[model samples]
Target: MRRLMSIVAILAVCGVIVSSVSLQHHYATSKTEYCDLGETFNCDIVNRSEYSSILGIPVALIGMLGYAAVAGLATVYRERRDTPALLLGGALAGFAFALYLTYIEGRVLGAWCILCLSSLALITSITPLSFVVWVRSRD
Candidate 1:
């Protein structure tokens, strides 16, 4: 179970990396052409919008750090089962943030960065998976 969670954490990190790339592209180009092309997943619009940068730091940077921490903690937890529920809580926390940003992108910015969407989906899935694992262990 720890191994599985660790793998999931790794995948989550990968999703975050993809999101960061898309965001960086938007920041560098400052255009919605490539990202907003599919209409379904418009990284361009989200990246150029006001919400791209939170306070002074870029949202993508935050995601990168967040995901990295998750992956690292998950790995540690995998090795040490005695550890508490920090990773579980962190996963939920990350999911909440991801959901919030995705909402802002889709509603306020009128765009849906594909990479970010994937990251959100990953977090959403992880929350449930982690919960199921935890619950099952209690039994």
Candidate 2:
């Protein structure tokens, strides 16, 4: 359980870091610039999204902060897997947010960034792993 949680946590944190860096790259090039890398690896839509920023902060930034908090919480209860209610809650929250962002990218944005999708995958993985960890803790 510890190893699984650690792996999940690492993946999720890497997702957050990558997303944040990508957003920062977009923000830097938002004006008269597009981080284009041919087709199927577009970051242009992410840069153009109206919802990409909230109160002057990038959405990716929010994701970074959120994932960081979740990681810390997971670590706090790392030894108490039997009562991992908080960790489960964190996983649920992360998974929901990731899925929502993925939907936004596919349906609303109409462009896909590999980094964002990877983040979504990480969150998705976390949800199931956390559940399994919680169950193992009980056993």
Candidate number achieving the greatest lDDT relative to the actual structure: 2
Task: Tell me the alpha-carbon RMSD of every candidate.
Answer: 2.6, 2.9
Q: How does residue 60 of candidate 1 score in lDDT?
A: 79
In TM-score terms, candidate 1 sits at: 0.80
Off by over 4 Å in 1: 30-34, 38-40, 81-84, 136-139
Q: By summed lDDT, which 10 consecutive residues of candidate 2 come out lowest?
A: 31-40
Query: Against the true structure, what is each candidate's TM-score?
Result: 0.80, 0.80
Model 2 misplacement above 4 A: 30-35, 38-40, 80-83
Q: Model 1, 26: alpha-carbon shift in Å?
A: 4.3
* lDDT, candidate 2, at 51: 62
Please give the range of 10 consecutive residues that has the lowest summed lDDT in model 1: 76-85
Q: lDDT, candidate 2, residue 93?
A: 86
